[model samples]
Every structure is written in C-alpha cells, then in structure tokens.
Target: MSRIPEIVFVTREEIIDELWNKGIESAFNSNIYAYTWYLDIVSPGWSALITDNYDYLFPLPTKKKYGINYIIQPLYCQQLGLYSSKHITPELVDTFIDNIPSKFKYVNINLNIHNKTDKHKSDTNSRVTYMLDLLNYDDQIFPKYKENTKRNILKAFAKNHTITTSLTPSEFISFYKYNGHIESPAKEIKIIKQLIECLIRQQKLTLLGCINQSNEIGSVALFAENNDTIYYLLGARNKRIKSSSLHFLLDYQIKNRSGLGKTLDFEGSMIPSIAHFFSGFGAKPCKYLNYTKNSIPASDLILRLKKELGL
Candidate 1:
C-alpha cells in the first residue's frame, strides 16, 4: 500500500524558514512573490499549507471582506500554488484542493505554471502568459520577430527614439496610470505602489523608457527580476507617437539582457489585442490555471452584489 501525504495548515511564523528552504530547492518556487519579505509587504497575515516533511507547499493569501474570509490573489503576485520539490501529480493537486480549510468559504487563486490537476467542481479558467528565451543575442533573435515588429523597430530607430533605464518607479507608475492601462481604484493603486517600492528596495526592479528625438518620454516599462526571469510587470506608451517606440523599448531590453541567459516573461493579458502584441515579439504562450470555489451558502448572491457595486 502507498502512503498518502498528510497536508497541514501552517501559521505565519512557520512560513518564512520552511517556504524559503523549499523554494531554494525547487525552481518553480524561485519566484520573488513566494519569498518571505515580498509576502510580508504585499500579503501580510498570509497562511500556508505544507506536508509533514515540508516537501510540498502552498501559500494562502487570505483577506476578510464583509465578514467572510477568503483566499485572494494578491496584486503583483503572478502565481502562487503547489510548490513542491517532488513531482506533482493530479492526485496531489486534488488532495490539496480537498484539504483547503472550510473557514475560507471562498477561494480564487492562480496556480503556478507547473501545477496540473483533474477537473474539480469549482470553476477552473485557463490563462496564458508569454515568455521569450533570451539565450540568443540581438543578431540571432531579431529575425524571429514578426515582420510588423521588425518594421516598428526600424521606424523607431529612424525616428531617433532612444532607450534609457533612468525612470524611477513612481514615474513609471504615474505614466502607466495616466495612459489608461490600469483601471484600478485608488486603494489598489496604493497597494501596487507599495509593492513596487518594496521590489525597488530589494534591487529587483528594472525601469526603462523610450525618449523620442524631441526628448519626450514616448514609452515606459517596468520589469521585475527573480530567478533568472524578467517579468514584464507594467508598460505604457504615448499614442501620439507614430513611431513604434514601445516595440523598440522592449527589443532593447531583451537584447541588453540577452547574454545573461534570462527569460522575459510578459505577465500577460488574455485580451486578444494584448496577446497579439506579445506574440509579435516571438514570445511563446505559457498556459496556467486559475482556480475558484464558492462554499458559502449565499456566495453567489454576495459575489453578484460585489460585481454590481464594482467592489
């Protein structure tokens, strides 16, 4: 007979050491969001699940709304589910889902790219992110880009748009917000700004901007670095620029970071147009899973009301 792994809920105090230890051993756990300091700032009071030997782990970033406790995917954290040193099986995923404490009443979170599971009762939506392998230098990589992307890069160069890494986090945030890319509320923006500041302090932030010949900022992007991957966290561009300044900016970053053997992760939008834009850069699609469950009696009604109120 085979032994079934026992899953137990761990308090906050136990998280830092164990999670970091496990993360160090697992490539998938290398994300900065899974780190203690990052979580402390972005998702304080978070709980977790772990096996007896601490081989498998899951972080539950919970929040209480309207007196109902639920697990939420925190801002700036891309994926947080099922980090294990051992091979993860469908059975293990199902076990973890089944063992999630009933107190949460509701759950909605995105699993890591490595996670896979058998279909469950709750909704499971598919999400896609884009990634470009940076092993090749510009000489070899540029040809892989779509023709339209190439044209844009050439146009940007002809327009004398220069790429610079001088933008501060606050400046990048302001540009992103004013460009109408992020429609989040003031409170949410505050939280995101705090996260950005924390990442900046940790030396994990990369801010780049494209300046046109007239010395105006035409495009800006903020990348978060962790575990040999540069995540395209946020970006915005001035629509008035007929030149493809944004395209040139991204290409410059990819080329500049190429020899370092990092992957550029376009933490993406399932929205068709955005997906198309990422694809133009020769980025491949990486599909992940978003899991949700509502166990409360009136959970549907509550969710509906929240949506209607834009909460």
Candidate 2:
C-alpha cells in the first residue's frame, strides 16, 4: 500500500534491458509496459503510466496529461498474470489528477468484482504479494513455530544429507525439476540458463542455496538490492528436503541478507499452502495493482463476447 521509492522513469528499452539484467520478478514488466504501453500509440488518448520499477517510465505529453478522476478517466487496468507494483498511492493518485470532478464518485476495489462462483475464486485477487521481512526470520522465533514444520527442518538437517550453500551442479538440476510443476514453467531451461549466465557476467545474479552434506536441498535466486529490501525472483526446495530444512535454508538466507534489507520476500505465492508457509514466517501480506483494460466500449464488448463464445 505504500509508495515504492527510487522512481526512475526510463524508456521501454531500458526497462527491458534492466529487467533482463537484474532478473526482475514481475509479470507486469512485459505485458503492461512492453506490450500495453503501445496502446497509447495505436489508440492515441490522454493516458500515462507511472511506475516505480525505475525503468519502464514512459515520457508522455505533459500538456495532454491531466489526471482525470480515476472513475471518469476511462483508463483501463492491464490484466497481466503477474503482480503489478504500486507506485502511486491515493495521495500520489490525487496529485496526478488535476480537474476535480464535481460529482460524487463511487469506485470500488473489490477483487473478483466481475466474476462470480468458482471462476472468481481462482484468480480472485491477482494483484497481491506476500512479503517476508527478514527481521521476522529470527532463530528465537523458530522454536515457537508449528510442530510439523519444526520437525521436518530438523529432520532434513539431521539426515546427514548434503546441503550446499551455493547452488552447484547437483542443485541446479534439482531446482529445474522442481519448477516443472508450476503452471507457467519459466522460459525453457535453456533460456533460464542463458538469462542466469547474462546475469552473473553482469554481476546481477543473486543466487543462494542449501544442500544436505552434498545433496542439494533448496535454492533461490533474486536481484535488486537497496538498503531496506530484497526482491525475490525464483526460489524452490528439493522435495527430498521437504523437511523443515528448506525453512532453515530460507531462514538462513533471509538472515544472511539482512544487511541489504529489513526483510526478505518469498515473493507472491498463488497457492494457499505456499502462502501459508510465507505467512508462518510472520510476513506481511502486501497488495499491489494488477490491471486489465479493454478497447472502447464496442471493442471491449467484442472481447467479452469472444470469451463467452469460446465457452
């Protein structure tokens, strides 16, 4: 809900390059900016996209820029499956908007507003992220945790298993295998390798791992660092180490990076179990904006019709 700082307004190319370099963990990067930003071009109108990602800032016509009450702005939200970072607050939003509409405006932020039944529940609120503050990852707090979670972590550590602090040949292989279960498998393994290669050469790669004696147990990769926060990119645990050791591993890493930030985000988890795991770490749930907009009324109607037709 807070406005992110260090707002850098850069061109689209720069944003992509920066994201590619830093491996920014955002779905909004490609869909919203790279693709949707072009909307203003094809369909010219007075619209502006403000973001705090520091990279994808579009320099729009300042003269044409008038922040209409969001209600009447006729602006659309992008519906990228990724979480949208919030750069504007009610205050900032107010600043952007100049002409105050005289009429009372009734707008709602209810998630799943358009969908009903199970369909809405599936992706009910697509714009929230779960952030874990590293300070929340304390050794003293671990003992007071759940019994099952506590037992597994200890079991894995006691298994005399191989745990590698840094991902090695074995860990890399396991990480990918585990990720295959996700709905959107990240770019092909080859692409990820290439991306990581580019990241490391540029020193943008922030990789961490935990292994049993020699067996790889858990690992995560991230980029971007300020004095107060660490943005998580990719993290996974070895099913073998499904033991609480993964918790210990992540906890160790969170503490390991406390210098860079007050907390470590496990990133947003769509699955309740995973979300619950992050919550167990005493992490705060954060809400960001995920938008989906359509063309003019006619065009938008057509799009909706197409969806129903498909059904």
Candidate 3:
C-alpha cells in the first residue's frame, strides 16, 4: 500500500508552498493567503511564512501568550500535510520549532476541521485557532440553519431581491462602499482584491452578488469553489439591507455546499459581534495549536535591541 510520505521540510518558497497548495487544492479558502501577507506587511518580522500562493506569503502577528510565530499563511486546511500543524507533535515538532527565529512573536494560526487523525489538541502556548463546523450538511446543499437564519434568507428571497456574483474590482468596490465594509477591513479588503485578481487570472473565482431591488442596495457573497469545499469568505451589503440579509445570501451558499466535505469551516470569529454573526449559522467550534520554537536568537536579540534603542 502506498503510504503517506513523511513531511520532509523544504524551502520556505518551495516546500512551504507545496503544503499550502495542497490545502488550496482541497478547496481551502483563498482569502487565507491575503491575511497571512498582511501580517508580513504590518510587522515584516522573522516571519517564516511559506506558501505557494504567489500573492500571499508573509508573517502575521498573534495576540497569544508570551511568544511569537512566523505565520506563513491561513487556510481551511483539512488534509494533514497541507493546512494543519497536526503532524508537528511535541516530540518531532521541536525540530521545526527550533528552526524558527524568536524575534517573530507572532504565532502561526491554521484553523482546521477535526478528524480522527488529528491527535494534537490546541492550547494557549500554540499558534493554532478555533473552528466552526457547519451543521446539517448535505452533499447537494448547505445544511439547515436555525429558524432566524431561515427567516432572513426567506426575507431576502421574498423581497424579490436580485442576486448576482462577481470578482470584479468595481463590484468589490461597490460591495465595500454599499455596506460600509470598507473600514476596519484593511487586511481583509486588500486580500479580497488580491484574491479577486488571482482568481480572475486563473478564471477560478466564483464571487456571488445580490442586490435588493426595492432599495438598489447591492449585497455581495464572495466564494471560491473547488472539488472538496466552498468557502463563504466575505459578505457585504449596505445598511439599507434590512436585517442584514446579505449575510443570508452568503449563508445560503454555505448551506448549499455543506455535504461536500466532512465539515464546513466558518473561517473565524475574533470579535464577539462577528463571532455572533457567524455562530448564528449553526456551525460547531473547532480549534488548532499555534506551536512556536525560538531558533533564531540573532533575530530575536536584534528585534529586542531595536525596540530598546528605539530604532
């Protein structure tokens, strides 16, 4: 029987990318790479973030415990080799951990679905993140959500709202401006543009657009589809979208794609308000570890020295 190959470490630009590519190939979200790159732009530290996604390869910061991590990329990683730190156990993980330069206090976070093989559980010390499993999945459709979501969706439908999908820059801008999804979404917005461009170049973006006929306010549901999963990454509609039905437009896409994989990942919920927004969709929580080992003393010392010198 062909066995799963041991994950031999490779170049940050090479092996790291293969790993990321593997996850993206398995239907991981495209926006993950952008956030990963944002960290690189914001801090640009000892980020050992490695990934194949050309537009996104950089370190991001974490507000975790006492240390930092070189987050290469974020993903809806399902497979062990691609999007998970599941293989880097306490015993063998040290090798990779030791290689990491300590200056990068930003821990890497890879949110993944829990399967039987993932023996490692997340903790405070690790750079892992939690997950939200989409419930009532069916291969042909998104699973059943709570009554409130159903009503919202029904309301969107009942209003005879016009819905369309796009990855066009104009459309994205429209969506951004319409819903005031512009502010406080710098990293996310930047990545959305990058992903839109990348997917458009590859002809792989399946951006969904919805418009309320009565108000002319446009709602957008941005999604990327692959063989295994469909990620409902971004949703935006103007305040005119009563009850925020644009969320429903996006949720409908998730429900339609639930049965396609073992679990549907609801990216993250850093803010309680946003968490509440995603939670209402009925996905259970999942988490991952953000493991770190400070190997680069020189980098760490330099960063510390710089901070002290005010340089």
Candidate 4:
C-alpha cells in the first residue's frame, strides 16, 4: 500500500523554494497567475497548501469578513488551484481540496484548467474562457477568423486607425478608469497598476493601443505572456469609435504573434455578445471550474440584502 503525502498550510512568508521555482525554469512552469510575485500584487495575504517536498501547491486567497476568515477569488486572478510539478491527477486535486483548512468556512474560487476532478462535481460550476492557437503564419491564421471579425478588422483599417504598442501602465490605467467602466474597487485598480508595472519590469507585459489619425486612443489591451502563451489580461475601448478599433488592435496582435507557436488566452466572458466576439476570432472555448460553499448562516441573505440596498 502506498502512503498518501501529507499537506501543510503555510502563510505567505513561509514559502521557501518558491512555487514553480519563482516561475524561472520553464520545465516547471504551470501558470503565471500562480506565480508568487503575481499573487503578492493581487492578494498580499495569500497562503497555500503544500507537500513537504514542494511538488504540489494550492493557493488560498483569503479575507476576513465580519470577523470570519473565508476564501474568495481575488480580483485580476482568472484561475488558481492545484499547481504541481508532477502530473495533476484527479486524486491529487481532491487531496489538496480536502486539506483546505476548516477555518476558511466559506469557500468560493476558480480552479485552473489542469485541476480536473469529479469528487466536487456537485458543488462546482463550469466557467468558459476562449483561446486562440497561433501556431501558423498570419496568412494561414487570418482565414480562420469568422466573417464578422474579418469585416471589423477591415473596417478598422479603412478608417486608417493604427496599432501602437507604447502605452505605459499608468496611461492604460487612466484609460481604463475613464473609458473601461470597470466596477472593481479603487484599491483593486491600484493593485492592477502595481501588477502591470511589475510585469513590465519582468518584460512579460504587452500593452497595445489603437490610435486614429488625430492620435486619439480608440482601443487598448494589456497582455501578459510567458514563453508560449499570451493572456489577454484587460482591455477597454472608446465608446465613441464608430469603427471596430478593438478588433483591429487584436488582429494586429494576431498577425504579429502568429507563427510563433503561442496561444492567446482571451481571459473570458460569460456574456453572450462578448463570447460571440471572442469566437469570431477563431478562439475556442476552454472550460474551468468554479467551486463555492457557504456554511455561514444567512450569508446569502446578507448578500441579497446588501445588493437590494445598494450596499
């Protein structure tokens, strides 16, 4: 009989060798969202469950609400769960989930694409994301785009809009604040700025903007890439643009990045129109899991009251 490995909970300062070797060695890279520095920016108080050998890890982004410490998904983090150096089997996922400390009574989070399991199927909901494979050249990849997307790209070009990759982090943040209509807390926006600056320093960030002849910003997007994948982290468009500058901006990236054997992860949209827009670019749906459990009394009722009262 084989013995199951023991898992221990540790605070942010306790991480020793760094998960994924601080995301240096590509051989051990799992997800950029799970990187220690990324977590520090997004969720400063993050902790984790790990084996003694550091083969596997489960990040817990926790917060204290009404004096109750609970796990909640942090802003700007798309997915985080069992990130391991070894094969992430269903059994391994269950083991880490089961070990989540009981102190975190209310749990709601998203697991990465790799953390597949049937054990929590009843409590988990499916979420959709979109990814475009960029293994082929621009000429080959352009044809795969749906007619609607192709038309939009043409429309943008007809308007003489140009794509620029020179937007600074603060500039993007200001654009997002004024034009993006983002509803996240101001503090979260600050965190995003910090994250963007950090990524820039690491040379992992790609900030692109679409500009008109008059040099007005029409659309912009921020992408973070590892060696092989680019995550469309955030984007915004000028509502006044009559043409499809956002589409033009994305198509520019597609053309620039195609033939590089990479993937473009459209971080996601559950809204039908947004999802359709992503699919129009030949992006395929990628499903992840959303797990939620509330053991606290009247939690839902309290949330409902807060929503009703506009709290």
Highest TM-score scorer: 4
What do the candidate models score in CA lDDT, each in turn?
Answer: 0.81, 0.42, 0.46, 0.83
Report the lDDT tens digits of candidate 4 across residue range 1-311.
23568999998788864544542233243667877788888888888888876777788997876557789998889998887666777777877888988888789999988778778888899999999998675566788899989899898888899988788777888888887757764886788789888898878999999998778999889999976889998888987766698999998898899887899999887989999999989899999999898877687658856876779
- Writing each residue's lDDT as its tens digit, candidate 3 over 145-262 gives 5576667778777777755553467776566755745545665556556666655665545676666756564566665544443455566666654555676566656655544453
Residue-pair clashes, model 2: 25
Model 4 residue 249 CA deviation (Å) reads 0.3
For model 1, name the residue pairs that clash. none
RMSD of each: 3.4, 11.0, 7.3, 3.4
Candidate 3 global lDDT: 0.46
Two-way lDDT contest, 3 vs 4, winner: 4
Q: lDDT, candidate 2, residue 200?
A: 59
Of the two candidates 1 and 3, the one with more favorable lDDT, higher being better, is: 1
lDDT of 1 at 200: 77
lDDT of 2 at 231: 51
For model 1, residues 167-230, the per-residue Cα lDDT tens digits are 8777777777777366566865776687788787878888899999999889998888987888
| Model 3 CA lDDT for position 288 | 39
